[model samples]
Target: AQSVTQLDSHVSVSEGTPVLLRCNYSSSYSPSLFWYVQHPNKGLQLLLKYTSAATLVKGINGFEAEFKKSETSFHLTKPSAHMSDAAEYFCVVRGTSGGYQKVTFGTGTKLQVIP
Candidate 1:
């Protein structure tokens, strides 16, 4: 079994300030994790993913995350928050169910970028 938890339901940041969105997860086996972003009236966009490769994963829009097995966490971070970054972020974990791979999403964290 696998599950994902977004530590913060909402994050407020000033434009040009650093952004941090915490996430924790658990799985019975090696899992694939992903981060997605959704703007208002838009579809979800893939940010980055971890599939047993590098611990530090970089995504578009200057977003990055580190997969920490020791801590069971994959926290997203961006050096400078942009106004366009204000959106809903989701942490996803891939698991198996009934011989099929299924992805589970976190409750989602709403990012508010203050100009």
Candidate 2:
């Protein structure tokens, strides 16, 4: 079985502060982790992914995440938050051995960016 658990359902940040969103997962086989951001009424965009490759992965919009095997965690981080960064973020896990690569989305973490 494969599953992902986002530690928080919401994360708030200032316009110029750092952002952090935590996630954990468990899979029988190797897993693919991803972070996607969705702006207001906008489709979700891929932010980053970990496919049993590099542990630390950088992504667009100055966002990044690190996959820790020992801890079974993939946490998203950003040095500075912008008003534009305010959105809903989802932690996803890719399913294997299926017709299509099923992507499981987290409940969602709402990022409130205060100016």
Candidate 3:
């Protein structure tokens, strides 16, 4: 079974400060991990992905995540938080179940940017 855990339900950061959204995942086999961001009244957008290629993956809008198998962690980070960055983030894990592809999602973390 594959599962994802987002350590924080809500993360508040200053407009110009660094942002960190913690996530941890478990899978029976090597899995694909992803981070998605959803703005208000908008669909989820793919931020970054780790597909066993590189440990560090960069995505749109200055976001990036590092896949650490030793720690079973895939945390999202941004150097500077923008007001536009405020949104709900989801950590996802993709694996196989019953020979079919399945994806497990985290509870989601809401990011709040403070001016």
Q: Per-residue CA lDDT of candidate 1, range 42-84, in tens?
A: 9999999997779999999999999999999999999999999
Mark the regions of model 1 whose C-alpha exceeds 4 Å error after superposition.
Answer: none
Give the better candidate number (1 or 2) by lDDT.
1
Looking at model 3, residue 17 earns an lDDT score of: 99
Candidate 3 per-residue lDDT over residues 20-112, each given as its tens digit: 999999999999999999999999999999978899999999999999999999999999999999999999999998999899999999999
> Of the pair 2 and 3, which is ahead by lDDT?
3
Looking at model 2, residue 92 earns an lDDT score of 94
TM-score of each: 0.97, 0.92, 0.98
Pairs of colliding residues, candidate 3: none
Go through the candidates in order and give the clash count of each: 0, 0, 0
CA lDDT scores, all candidates in order: 0.95, 0.89, 0.96
RMSD of each: 0.8, 1.5, 0.6
Ten-residue region with minimum lDDT total, candidate 3: 44-53
Candidate 2: where is the Cα deviation over 4 Å?
Answer: 97-101
Instruction: Report residue 69 deviation for candidate 1 (angstroms).
Output: 0.4
Best-fitting candidate, measured by lDDT? 3
Error of 1 at 55 (Å): 0.2
